[model samples]
Target chain A: EDQVTQSPEALRLQEGESSSLNCSYTVSGLRGLFWYRQDPGKGPEFLFTLYSAGEEKEKERLKATLTKKESFLHITAPKPEDSATYLCAVQSGTSGTYKYIFGTGTRLKVLA
Target chain B: EAGVTQFPSHSVIEKGQTVTLRCDPISGHDNLYWYRRVMGKEIKFLLHFVKESKQDESGMPNNRFLAERTGGTYSTLKVQPAELEDSGVYFCASSQGLTNEQFFGPGTRLTVL
Candidate 1:
């Protein structure tokens, strides 16, 4: 069975603090790993897509790195505006109808 | 360009009532998806439509849910005789071709009394 799990269900970070959220997965075949940021009452916004192990992507204060069995979303000196639920999803399957499994997500609070 | 859009930001109905949620994907997007998140639960995939054709309905919870995308344009998810367990936020997403990046809508909050 393919499943995704995110650790540190909730995190409270002081402004300027740096931390990392983890997403571990077990899938038949890894096609893509995605990161998204979701604010209250709003849809999730795309952040990054890591396709292979050793791949990394960055945007401003956020960086995402991938490994064979897991992914990490690192926040560097996060600000209060960076507070939101971070979601991880993995697309796997050799068949044409791929399955996208999502983690429970990590709620991050960057207090100013 | 406008992002994906869903109608009726919130809906409240009694159990056994039917509700129809609509979504208009980004223009020219061929892949549309429906997802739901019940209270205290992670969002789960409901179905996927590729140009008016049901590509994957395996994630759909039950037969009481019906999804349709006509003319490869907008899509609708109708839940007939909705149950308490069906109360949740319904989200719609869209992508182009085989692209993995999917844009999502604000979502519709459904409440069953």
Candidate 2:
């Protein structure tokens, strides 16, 4: 069964603090890994998509890195505005579908 | 781009009652999807529609949860005789195609009392 597990269910950091959230997955055939940021009362916003191992993508203060077994979302000097639930999802290439398996998000709270 | 839009931001209904949620995808998006996140749970896929066709409905929980995409445009999800477990945030998203990214709408929070 394909599954995704994220570590540190919740994390708190001060403004300008750097940290990383981990997402480990077990899937039949990995097609892509997606990262999203969700605010309190809204749907998630797309962040980055990593296709293969060693692949990396960046946007503003966020960086996503993918590997064979896991992916990392590195936050660089995150500000309070960056506080949100970070979600990691994976699409199985074997399925050839848009049905993505999502991980229970990591709730990040950045305080100023 | 209008992104995705859903109607009735919140709905509070009684168990055994019926409720319908609507979603209007961005114009020109061929793929529309429905997902739900129960309290404390990760958002899970419910179904997918490619234009007016039901591309994938495997993720739907049961027959009581009916989804329709008419005219290859807006879609609707209806829960007949809703259950207490149906309480959660239902999200609607749309993508241009297989390679394009999905755009989400502010979800509709369903509360069954």
Candidate 3:
């Protein structure tokens, strides 16, 4: 079975703090890894998609990097407004169904 | 363009009651998806619709759940005789095509008492 696991169920950071969230996966073939930010009572917003190893994408204070067995969402000098639950998901290559297996997510709280 | 939208942002019902959640995908989007997140659990795929066709429904839990996307515009998910375990936030998402980024709605929070 394909599975995605995210670490640090909850993280509390001070303003300007930098940290990284981990998403490890085990699957037959990896098609894509996705990162999303979800606010309370709202749907998840897409952030980045990593398709292969050593690939990295960034936006604002957030950066996403992928490796052979895991993906990292790095937050640099984050602000309070950036506090939200960060979710990671993976799509398998053979599913052909476009189904995404998501992790439990990392809840981040940025304080001033 | 308006992102995916879902109706009845929150619904509270007793066990055995039926609830229907609606989703309006972005205009011209051909790929629509339904996902749910149980409390403290990961969000999971329920089904996928390509236009008006049921492209994939392997994630459906049981026959008690019925999903339809008639005419390829709006979609509905009906839970009959809902059980306590069915309580969760149901999310609707859409994308233009395969490999296209999916846009999600605020979600419908369903609570079965």
Best-performing candidate as measured by lDDT: 1
Each prediction's TM-score versus the true structure: 0.98, 0.97, 0.97
Candidate 1 CA-lDDT value? 0.93
What is residue A78's positional error in candidate 2, in angstroms? 1.0
Fnat scores for every prediction? 0.67, 0.65, 0.77
lDDT of 2 by residue, B43-107 (tens): 99999899999988989999889999999999999999899999999999998876456788999
Q: Chain A: TM-score in each candidate?
A: 0.98, 0.95, 0.96
DockQ metric, candidate 3: 0.78
* Between candidates 1 and 3, the TM-score winner: 1
- lDDT computed for candidate 2: 0.92
Per-residue lDDT of candidate 1, residues B1-113 (tens digit): 99999999999999999999999999999999999988778889999999999999999999999999989999999999999989999999998954478888999999999
Where does model 1 exceed 4 Å of error?
A: none
Instruction: Please write out the lDDT profile of model 2 over residues A2-108, one tens digit for every residue.
Output: 99999789999999999999999999878789999999999989999898999999999999999999999999999999999999988774443656889999999
The two-chain DockQ for each candidate, comma-separated, is 0.76, 0.71, 0.78
Error of 3 at B106 (Å): 0.5
Best by DockQ: 3
Q: After superposition, how far is residue A77 of candidate 1 from its true place, in Å?
A: 0.5
TM-score of 1: 0.98
